[model samples]
Target: MSTLVVRRAPITRVLRSELRMVLRRPRTLIGLGLLALVPVLMGIGIAIATANGEEGGAEGLAALVIGNGMLLPIFALSIAMAMLLPLTGAMLAADALAGESAHGTLRGMLMAPVGRGRLLAVKAFGVASVTLIAVLLMALTGIISGVLLLGGDGMLTASGTSLPFLDALGRVLITALYVTLQVWALAAVALAVSAFTEHPLIVVVVSLGLVIVSGVLAAIPALDWLDPVLVTTSWDAVSEVVRDPIEWGPLVEGGLRALCYLVIGGSIAYSRMLTRDG
Candidate 1:
């Protein structure tokens, strides 16, 4: 008598297939398209405001981006981190597992020769790819539109000094990377929630609900003690990048907080996947 051995698929092959599936989805394309357009619309609106002698009427980041195109990506990233990027992360994470489970495809994957851990890794890769792509798309569009509408100029630092183009560009890239990490943390939590339910909507709702609750908790002065534990509390640190001296304390703190969430969420999802029926 002989035992049969099933061959496991290569990781690259699995990851490639997963990415193709994710990138080809209509919803994915549509979501990314919308994300890309946001920065363009923002540039147009800023241009219009400036043309109307309303440049001084703008406030905060908007006021800074009035003529400095290099700041546009940073401005767009700030807005996205508040809500849009997190929402995208939740939706992609939900579709990664819950949507597949609802459509009966997850069982097939579970029964395959692939280990559950590897399956989770592949799903994560796909989700991360979508999230990263979404961010990059926004950044690219912001750059193009800002340069066209606002004029290519050095970024104005919070200290009222101007940075060289290369330096400003580097800062924008760093901001993008930092924002991506925050969204990844949220996606990890959504993945954990997705592991327990076949309803994609539940994953999105739960993930976003957590975000909203965190923001609200962080805003309350009495909850100062809780600020250390809330993810949203550290988000304001993103502005530190554009500061003249570049305050590293808050940025480092925020990155570490995000990593904690990533580890916790990934661990929970792995544990549930190990014991789940499919």
Candidate 2:
């Protein structure tokens, strides 16, 4: 008898292939393009309002961005996080497992020589990358459009103080990372859902429904008791970065909450993958 050897694929190569498959998808490209446009549209809207002497009506971060161009990325992220950002994450998660299953590729992947747990990890990484890219694209476009339309006026803190360019950029990066964590939590939930379904549309619908329901529940004063468990409850904490001293309390709490979701979601996904029948 002759002994034969089989080599496992390198993890880096698997991840790179997964990422390429994700980025080359037409829907992924289209979604990213649209996300990049959001900040540009916001910048244009603000510029037109300023030209028309309507800046007085602006409020919240939008008002702040008028005077602080560097704040535009933060402002756009604040708006996008509520819907578009999470939706993009949800879409990526849907495509990770459910889409592949629907196309009959998931069964093939499950039957491959790679361990199922490692396969789940690769899918999760691909989804996570999509969310990160979507956020960075929006931020980059926001920064460019803000500079062109509003000028780089540094950044204004909630305390009515000004921050230098580098300091403000650091804050913007922190804010982006914070928002990305929250969206990643959402994507994890979607990925778990994806493992349970063969229909990608079902994953998207269920994930989005969870988001809307969480938002609604968070809005109810009576549901204050549920604040600690609700996912969207701490989403607004991203604004804490805009303060002069950078409030760490809410941000830390929000990040911890997201971590909990990430753990639970990943656990469920892995369990399902292990028990799944090919």
lDDT of 2: 0.90
**Candidate maximizing TM-score:** 2
In model 2, the clashing pairs are none
lDDT of each: 0.90, 0.90
Q: Write model 1 residue lDDT over 1-278, tens digit each, in one string.
A: 29876777787998999999999999999999999999999999989888888855667777788888988988998999999999999999999999999999999989876789999999999999889889988888988888899985778887798999889888888898889999999999999999999999999999989999998998889988999988787788888988888888999999999999999989999999898776
lDDT of 2 by residue, 165-252 (tens): 8898898899889999999999999999999999999988988898899988888998889879988878899889899888899999
Candidate 1 to truth, TM: 0.96
List the RMSD of every prediction in angstroms: 1.7, 1.3
Which ten contiguous residues of candidate 2 have the minimum total lDDT?
A: 54-63
On a 0 to 100 scale, what is the lDDT of residue 147 in model 2?
A: 82
Report residue 160 deviation for candidate 2 (angstroms).
0.9
The C-alpha TM-scores of every prediction are: 0.96, 0.97
